[model samples]
Target: MAETNATILIPDISGFTEFMTTTELSHSSRAIHMLIDAMLNAIGEEYEVSEIEGDAVLLIKKGPAPSKKEILGICLKIFNAFHSQRMWMQQYTICPCGACKAIINLTLKFIVHYGPLVELKVGRFVKQSGMEMIVAHRLLKNSIDSHEYLLMSEKLLKQVNDSTETADMVWGNAFEEYASIGKVGYHFALLNEARKNVPAPQAPQSYYRKDSTPYLQTTIAANFLDVYMVIMNIPGRAEWMPGLQKVEQDMPDICIGSLHHCLFENHQSTISPLLMISSDEEINYAESCRIEEMNISLVYEFVFKKVDEKSCHFSVRFMNAAELPIPEETRGILLENMQRMAEKLKLFCEK
Candidate 1:
C-alpha cells in the first residue's frame, strides 16, 4: 500500500441511465462510449485515468493539485469535446432509432477533490482507495441542480480558491451528507455559459453529385434498422462484399469522422464516411474512397426507402467517377462486382 496525496477528478456522463434504459441498447451503448472517448482525448496526458465506472471516468494526478485556472481549462476542454462529438453525431447520423435521436439529451458534469490516496495493487491493477476517495465518489450524488457543471470539494476549493477568473461559469455553494463522512461542502459552477463557446459541427462532406444516377438498385427483405446494421458493420463487410479481405478502424463504432482502411484482395483503399441522413420514410448514406493503386476517387451512395415494417428498397450508385474517364470495360467490371455484392448483402440481411 502506497499512501500519498493526489487530486481526483471524475467526469461523469449525466442522463446516461435514462438514455441507455429507454433508447435502443445497440446504438445507445456505442454513443455513450464514443462520448467518453472524446473526454479522454481532451484530458490528454494531464491526468492518469484510474478507472471507468459505468457512466463515470475516475482520473487522478498524484502529488500536488492544479491551480484554479488549470482545472477550469481542463473542464472546459472536456465539455467542448463532449458536446462537439454529440453535435457531429446528431448531424450526420443515419440511424433514426431512439438512441441516436436521444443523444442530444445527454450531458456532462465533473467532480474534483484533493486528498490522501491509498494505492493498493491487486493483480495487475492498482486501485485508489481511502476515505477521501469515498468522499469524492459520494459527492457525485449531490444536489447539483443542473446536469452540466463543475463541482469542487471544499478541501480542493480551499487549495485552488473558490472564485475563478473564468467569467462564464455561474458559481454557487452546496453540501451533501453521508453516513460515514457527515456533511461535505462543495462549490459548483454551471457550465451552460461555457458550452455556448463550443463550436458547431461542420457540414458533412458531399461525395455524390445530385444528378448522379444509380448504377444498381434492389430491395432487401428486412427492416430498415436490420439493413442498416448490416451495412454499418465494417467487419461483416467481408461476408457480403466481394474481394474485401479486412476493414480496420481505430474505434469500434462508426461515426461521422470515422476513417476505415479497407484491404481488398488486390488493392487497398482509404474510405471515410461522407454523408448520412435518416427519417421514417427514407435513409441516405454515402462514403468517399481513394484507391491507392488506381489513384482515382470514387463516391458510393445508398438510399433506403421503407417499403413496409419488414422490407426496404435500397439503391446504390458510384458518383464522381465520370471525371476519371474510366474505360467502359472497367466500368462494366465494377458494376458486375457491385451487383453480386448487393445480392449477397440482401441475403445476409434476410438471414
Candidate 2:
C-alpha cells in the first residue's frame, strides 16, 4: 500500500436513486452515462479520477490541498457544465425516450474533503482506501438541506489558507461527527446561490407581445442559422415541447401535403397537416394540429428573423383555430412555456 496526502472530491448526481427507480432502466442508464461523461469532461486536467460510484464520481488530487481559488473555480465549472449540458439536452435531444426527456429533473452536488489516503491497486483499478476516503464518502450523507449544493470538509478548508477571493462565497458549520474523522467541521454552498455570487453571462433579450394574444419573441446572441435549424426540425420537437413522446411524418419527404402525427404522454394525440410555406427560403413554418375529441385545433407558427450580424429574433406563435378567447392565466402559462423553450434553445447553441 502506498500512503499519500490527497484531496478527495465526489461530485454526485443527487436524486438519481429515485430517478432510476421510476424511469425506464435502459434510457435512464444511458442518460446517466452521458451525464457522467459530462462531469468528467468538466474536471479535465486539474483532478484525477479514482473511481465512479453509481451517480457519484470519486476525484482525488495527490498533493497539497488546492487554494480556495482553485476549488471555487472547479466547483463552479462543474456546476455550470452540469446545467449547460442539461439545458442543451433539454433543448435539442430528439431521443423521445422518457428518461432522456426527464433529465431536467436531476441536479448535481459535491462532497469535498482532504486527508491522507492509502492507494492499493486491485487489478486494473486503483482504489483509494483510508480514513479520509471514508470521511469524504460519509460527507455525502449530510444535513446540508439543499439538493443543489457543495459540501467541503473542515480539513480541506484548513489547507487553503488564502481565499480572500472566495471568502464571501461560503458559509460554515462548526462541527459534525464521522466514524473515522470525529467532530468533523465543514462548509456548504448552494450551487444556485454560488451562481448569483459569481459574475454570470448576460441573458438574452426578450420581448413578448403586449397584446392579450399569446406570443414570445427573443433575440438570442447566435447565428440566425443556428437558431433556425432547431426551430425547423419538426420531428425534433420532442426536445422543446413537453408531454410529446414521439413525432412521426408519414411521407419520407415533407411536401405541402405531408401528414404528421404526434403521440403525447397523456394518451392524447394530434394529427397535423404540414404546410410547405418556406421550407428552405427562410426559417418560417405553419401547421395545425387537431384535438378531435375537444373539437378544437391549435395553430402553431414558427418565425425567425435576422436581427444583426451576430444575433437573430425568434418567435413562437400559438392560436386556437376557432378564434376563441384565451384565459388570461392560460395565456400567461403559454407565454412562459414558450419563453422557456426559447431560452433553452438559446443556451443549447450559444454554449
Candidate 3:
C-alpha cells in the first residue's frame, strides 16, 4: 500500500440544533441543505468532495498541499458564498416560522490539515483513512470561543511557514485533547475580516405601480403565515391552482433567481419568483413570466394582510411588464381562471 499525501478540509455549520417542532424541523432541514449546496458550488475544481457529514462537508485534495495564501483565499470565498446565501434566504422568505426566521443566526467554520493518508477502495468508493484524517476531524471540536473561524493543524502551518506570502496575518493558538493522540495544537484565524467584505444581497426588482389594482381579490379564513406557506409550496400548487398540471422546481429552495416550469392544460410557462417582502403587518410576493403565445410578459403579485389570528386578506394582481395593451378577452379569461383558483385556494388553506 503506497502512502499518499493529502490535505483535508471540512466546512462545518454551527447553530444547528434538533430541538424544534415538526414545522420548524422540516423548514430547518431544507434551509441547511440549501446553505450547504451553496458552499459546495462555490468550491474550485482543485478539491474533491469526500463526503457530506450532516452539518459538515468533508473535502480532500491529493498530491501537493495548497499554500497558506491559497487556503485563506478559499476560506474567504466559502464565507462569502455562505453569507450571501444566508442573506438571500432571510430576505426572500415569506414563512414566519421559527425555523425560517432563525436562518440568520446560522454560522460556518473551516478545518484544514495537511498530512499523509492511505486510500482504501471499497468496491467503487474511495475512502481516505489514517492518523492524519483523525486529527483533522478532531480539530473540529477545539476550544474556539467564536463559531466562525479557520483552524489549521500545526503541521500544515509549518509547511505554510516555508512560503514567503505570509504578511499582515494574525493567528491565535488552540489545542484539543484526544484519547489516543494525547493533545494536538492548531492555529486559528477569525473570519470577521472576510465576512465584512461580503456585500449585502441586492433586493428583488419590483414591477408594481401606484395605480395598479388587483385583478382578483379574496379573503381566506386562515392565518397569514398559513396562507403564505400554502402558496409557496410549489409542488402543492397543482392541487389548489386551476389548470396547473404540474410544477418542476429547478432548485430545492426558492429564491429570487429560482425558476420552475409549470405544465398547464394547453401550454407551459417558465415562472421565476422576483420579489418577496414580509413585515409585521403584511407580506408581498411577486412572480414574472413571459407568455410566449401572447407575446407579452406578465408579473403576478400576491399580497397578504393579517386581519386577525384566524383570518386574512389575500389579493392577486396581474401587471404587464412590457407595458403593452392587453386584449379585453385575454384579460377576462385570466380573471376568470384566477377567480376559480382563488376559491379553491381558500378552501385548501382553511381546511
Clashing pairs in 2: none
Residue-level lDDT of model 3, residues 258-335, one tens digit each, is 788888897777788777778877888888876677676777888889999989999987777777777889878777
TM-score of each: 0.83, 0.57, 0.83
Order the candidates by lDDT, highest first. Answer: 1, 3, 2
Residue lDDT tens for model 1, 1-351: 899999999999999999989999988988988899998999999999999897989999988899888898898898899999999889877567899999989889999999999999999999999999999999989887789999999898777753347654667988998996899998888988777889998977654555545558888999976787678666679777888999988766576667788899989887777777778788788887787676667778878889999999988887654476666776686678778878888998888
Q: Alpha carbon lDDT of residue 250, candidate 3? A: 77
Q: How many pairs collide in each candidate, listed in order?
A: 0, 0, 0
Report the lDDT tens digits of candidate 2 across residue range 1-351: 999999898888988998898887977887788778878898998899998889888999989998877887898888787777666555444333457567979988888899899989989988999888888888777877788887888789888875677766666575577664677788886777764443343332221222344457777887665676565565776776666678888854332334567776654445443332332224565566575545556666767677765787777777766667656675576567567677787786577
Q: CA shift at 273, candidate 2, in angstroms? A: 17
lDDT (C-alpha) at residue 203 in model 1: 73
lDDT for 137 (candidate 3)? 88
> Model 2 off-target regions past 4 Å?
95-97, 179-181, 195-351
Cα error, candidate 1, residue 197 (Å): 0.8
